[model samples]
Target: MTILTIPITFDKSHLITIGEKLYSESIELIRELVNNAYDADATSVRVTIAEDEIIVQDNGSGMDEQGLRQYFNIGSTEKRQHNRSPKFNRIRIGEFGIGKFATLAACGRFEVTSRKDNFAATVTFDKEEWEQSNNHWHLPMRLEAPEILKTNGTTVKLNKLYKKFKLDDVERRILEGVPIKAEHFEVYLNNKKISARFLAGQRIPVFEGSEYGIISGELILVSNTNFIVGGPGIEIKVKGVTIKRDLFGMEINFPQLNLLTGEIHADFLPITSDRTGFIKDSPGYHEFNKVMRGVLQRVLHDIKYWQKQKEKKKNRRIVNATVDKVLNALKKNPELASLIGLPVSPEEEKQKTEGEILPKKPRVKRTPAQKRMVSKILGPSAVVARLKIGKKGISCQLDHFGQDSPESYTESNIIYINLDHPLYVREAKNRERLIVNVARLLTQELTLLKNPKNARQAFDTQSKLLKDTLIDTTP
Candidate 1:
């Protein structure tokens, strides 16, 4: 009798069959490049896109030969000379050490070129080799010292495009992922500046205040007011590689709200590839959170305060509608006047004195605008003004008797707006611009309402905003 036996040995980690990693992870790739740009000290960045090509160029300080080799490594083992962190002070915006490889997901080929002190070099990443090889994480191309290069910045060219690309969409994604300023480090998508910050749909002016935050003890801070309002993205600090992003979702949903919905500029908030996903517990997250702790609460308080004002306005509208309905019904049914304590008979009313016998229709109540003014001036620090009803609308008065303001606002700023509307006009000193803008918008809406042929009324509560009065802001 003859017997045969076979022996087998395999490593558990390498058993999986799919050795090739798909390049569908586009957003992270773009993010890596953007973060690297920040590390290069770039104030002006450009992201250019075509059907088959994606280019990211930044004007940050370029790299030297030794710097290039160290940057190519996956980890910053060489950068550990200064132990706390390898990135620049927070003012510069990078902290993590791994965003560089993100770009590998976008193309079959990628190239990087940088120059420092009159010397330049180029490096290529071959994706085919990465996918075909057993270990898919390392760069396939060798770093060759170039004979000549004039410019002193880094450029990454991603070829054999992995996914369909669109310029508008990609630009938007960059805006959300890397909140850079147009003036400080102007960012352009196909040479056009992005505008997605203000309700006006244009760039907001830079608030003249500069501040910094210490995330991982790197210089990370959001400076200026205008850029955040324009279309600012994010900055990462990794030792090697560049990443790309999806370019659409990140810009619109970066902070879980509209671009104009909240304040911007916090460094330590590391990000993942899509650009919308932020790392909440990064090395310096807690320190960064310390600065933002009260800020978010104040923002929430402002929103709630606005909401309460809206509720009051809604109630006012109902009361006004009820008053009008009662008046109309009263004219048609004169018989019920006596039940409401009005004159019973026409002859009896004629015999009575001119003004003494008949009671005036119960005076409708009103609220004074002064009360609302005080609330706005004091904001969450104080309570809102009290209100009284009038025959047609409501009058609001400052609720606190001890409060007084010698300072006065311009007539243009003294606008009485009902809370039901969502028109957030930018900061302005002239009311004409705001009023005219509102008028044009409302007129357009009215035109639509007049021609609403079949469905529910266009002028219904859900579709329109009503503002019937204006009070002066001057003392």
Candidate 2:
């Protein structure tokens, strides 16, 4: 094998292009700058929006001349090597050393003023001058004494804005973007405080680990609403900073999922330079997704069960109303009353018909798979209900007069569902509605059992109503 080394060079325009294309929105530009402030150990950051300029001032340790040199270096790994911010021990969010140019994306010219131990230096970047220069160009730096009396901090001023950003939007984005709730940190936009509010729901702890430290977060199901608000879905936070908000992407497309919101704190996952999303192929990112998918499935199952309970309650009321109406109508009409009778007792009838001639039994030809499935379902004598998926059919059994019967009789509390049946196959696609249908069938059976004398009358009345509805809807 031969050893090879190549020096890579970058065009100034291309370097500028990456920064300009890094963010999709004007709010994202502000977010990146604020994150820079956070990485600098700034406890408080104030953003001021003027008609032609934007100013971000942070009360944190200011940069010295050496730090200034590294800051302007396009791909400097200084922050990665240093790792954490001084004084506060905050995790550094920027490593590529190109975040400063993000401001240049929004403006033609921008300046960084820093003060450290009565020593101050100001650096300015002029896009026009850089464009007119040779391939080699550098941001102009001016070292001087302090002009203003701020002891130790940094201030960034962006002049000649490329695009207008609404102050209110800037505040909203900051609130959603950064981890404002971290102790001792505060963000102010146009003098208004920007803070993070926890979602209103049952808090669920989420934790995972890799070569890095343990990653943790909370998965919550907010109250009342079926969709998440403020910061919907999950936020992927690395070192107490948001890398991607709504991490699940479209929230598994569930309305109740809107009630489901979470914050995933996994700094181990690597992100692209833009920081809008994670590198999907990374081992750490894959593990994070696997864990999150499990959490999402569990939450969805819980939501499904909860929905079923609510629907069951509502349907029970409807069943009771229908039963009452049938009983009342039967009492009012003599002809209907005559049709209502107590169900027959199979055991007593069998004893009385011992001398009668037996009828020929019909032979049923069932496939081996069907026979196996039937055995599996009927094997458990204690099981009151079962739903079996098979070829094109729906057969339900209701417990008749508290008596045990053969599998062939519709006298046990079991429901068999053939998924191959076109109607049920369509309903299966919608899980929520399918659950409701199953519950409705069970509720109807239970309602009949409650008033067995009126069951016939109630069933007849329902059948007539259904027929009338079918006729009315027919073209």
Candidate 3:
């Protein structure tokens, strides 16, 4: 029996289709090229954008003829085999050699010129010409003298561009996509150096060991709300290159998550061909997802704690402002102060003495035991406000008493308001209602001190005092 040999092959158009699909954004090509330079042990990469062309030049270990041949070989395993740079020993950023195809998505023609030791050459690939040449598999190259390159490095010139590239857009892409934080590596766009985006906030350092590798980096809870303009998520990186920004399914409606931004590095995480997502079925990614879920749980807890603290501070301010308004109103109404058994100014006292109708009772001071009981009821966590009424000082304390407790009670100069009262807890949902409820409780306690027997007169006095105190005095 005779056997026939066959080989798998694809059309040139398939190459173009793969490239366009792999690199959906034209700006992504810049990241691919920059990463290529990084893997070459480059110290610096300069990207120049012009009206009609874009140039990427890097000071790295340039390729020789054989190296250039391997570079053009699609899906070459050379980089995967030797995963570190010879010069700087950097963990190579490029895995699948097919990344070079990404250039076709942005330009009609691209040229690569490199010089290493005594070898120097330039290879040009024109998309239009390559497609027209039915079965041609070779590209045009020109040998140049070593002096042409000046030093060892590579320069990629993308000509016949399909679209215009703004410097700001390119810089932003590099900041997010490239690993500018790598040691001894720098990227420049339009002569301006591109640096890693810095977030100012509480940074939680993460260093967890997974079965695949170590998942390490910092997660920042940005303090400035203005800086939270862009999309919110943490960038997942492999081998220093950012693969994608993700929340790992921990996304929620919490506003604090909007301020979340940082990077997580897991070199062993298996990424898809486009590098836009992870291969979820892989064991490496499973472990990574599990670890991230645990980390985010802690982050969520911190965000909740931060939110509570902020609300607590805001509530304290509101309480102080409300108390100040009440004190100011009390000073303006001497009649109200007299009925509440509170001391008034000396001038008001002189006028009241001149027209004395009812006999006055001397103010009674509290004993040490009563003071201790007030302190115990208020508790350490209670919110306290203090103000002076003429020469006497008054203290207002808010604390949680059982629902059966009275709304408020006065002990000497101290008034304790029950926060857990049915009315208070119900009205606390609205700030205005909360202020009114507190004022009503204060009026009840103060009025009871002077006229405990006359309910009708006491209610009338409280209504008058509350009307005056709750007036819109804020200007």
| C-alpha positional error of residue 5 in candidate 1 after TM-score superposition, expressed in Å | 34
Model 1: lDDT to the true structure: 0.44
Write one digit per residue (lDDT tens) for candidate 1, span 408-471: 1111112223322323123112344444333333323322323444445544421332222112
Q: What lDDT score goes with residue 358 in model 1?
A: 25
lDDT (tens digit, per residue) of candidate 3 on 1-475: 9999999988888877777778778778898899899999889999999998899999899999998998799889888899989988998878887887888888899999999989999999898998899999899989999888878999999999998988878887888778888899999997989987666888889999987899999888887657743466787888877788778766765555767778899999988776777898998888899999899888999887776566556556656877776776776666656643345777655554433332354655755543444666444347787655434456778765667676777765667877667987788788888888877877666666555558898898777667767895647
Q: Cα lDDT of all candidates, in order?
A: 0.44, 0.63, 0.79
Off by over 4 Å in 3: 1-4, 223-226, 252-258, 332-382, 388-395, 399-445, 448-456, 463-475
User: What TM-scores do the predictions have?
Assistant: 0.48, 0.65, 0.81
Candidate 2, superposed: residue stretches over 4 Å from native: 1-7, 147-149, 210-213, 222-232, 245-259, 312-475
Q: Report RMSD for candidate 3.
A: 5.9
Best by lDDT: 3
Q: Give a tens-digit lDDT track for model 2, residues 66-102.
A: 8777667778887899898777787788877777777
- Poorly placed runs, candidate 1 (over 4 Å): 1-24, 77-90, 129-150, 199-305, 321-475
